[model samples]
Target: MNTSTHYPNAPVAQPVARHTLAVIVDNEPGVLARIAGLFSGRGYNIESLTVSETEHDKHISRITVVTSGTAHIIDQIKAHLDRLVPVHRVVDLTLQGEALERELALVKVVGKGEHRVEAMRLASAFGARTLDASLTSFVFELTGSTEEIERFIKLMTAVGLTEVSRTGIAAMSRGPDAM
Candidate 1:
């Protein structure tokens, strides 16, 4: 009898880490579904997802996915992504030191008097640009790291924040290398 040491069904007890993966894939129909399915079917949660065609002539799209998982799970995810027909390459941007990440957000605040002044002052302090302003409301545009955006939104809430729309993180490796 052969002894088996691997337990496929065993629960994993390991430290989970947040990672950002950039997948280069062909721009085609159903490609996004397949990528999303890979995560959904495996019970992996995608914290943030951004996809855009980086090469128009080549019909290639770059998909940036942020997720949390153990190291083993992350390796498995990368392997699976690499096996996809449309995927050309999978790079773990989190592992690449000094990767740059940024997001854009539009925040709308509704208030008058002190609230309005305070909100504008807060926005100005954060380098948020006023996109629109009226007697009762102002829409501000801000772009920065995710943490910065979160902090700005939280402070806005105290100053009559009414709505916010965000563009998911757009990231890339810094310096001379291209992922």
Candidate 2:
């Protein structure tokens, strides 16, 4: 005798995908807070967020938010954002084909003698510029993809890495279209 069991009404789980969403809104006080509140209230995680006024004359600001979730969750997030009073537009850059994303980081390393030399060498290899230098410490500025910055910081650990500050990812679609 052979037996098999199956549930006909079982729900299938969708795979989670990372998405980069660009949001356009009025450049006014409390706009950022409202956006953040939306994510916090919904329990959605924001991996990276960057916001700045894109159109000074028009008083429009662009927010780049990197997040991960199932397709349904992403859709819900976008829909909720659209309902917000200040939101003008929301674009999923990840699904919009080719896009360019970059971040800036400032890394400080404290070293002496050979350690300092090694830090300089590694910075040069990573195309980082020395923004400040003293007898015992050096501050390097680097701009690149998130992974590149992480790798550079990891490598610097062996050369007396001390502190770091990073600007979250800024992304935009390629070609002539404006977001």
Please name the candidate that would achieve the greatest lDDT relative to the true structure. Answer: 2
- Where is the poorest 10-residue window by lDDT in model 2? 1-10
- The whole-model C-alpha lDDT of candidate 1 against the native structure comes to 0.94
Q: TM-score for candidate 1, please give it.
A: 0.92
Q: How far is candidate 2 from the true structure (C-alpha RMSD, Å)?
A: 1.8
Off by over 4 Å in 2: 1-5
lDDT of 2 by residue, 1-179 (tens): 44353766567899999999999999999999999999999999999999999999999999999999999999999999999999999999999996799999999999999999999999999999999999999999999999999999999999999999999999999999876
The candidate scoring highest on TM-score is 2
Provide the clashing-pair count of each candidate structure: 0, 0
| Candidate 1 residue pairs in clash (backbone atoms < 3 Å) | none
TM-score of each: 0.92, 0.95
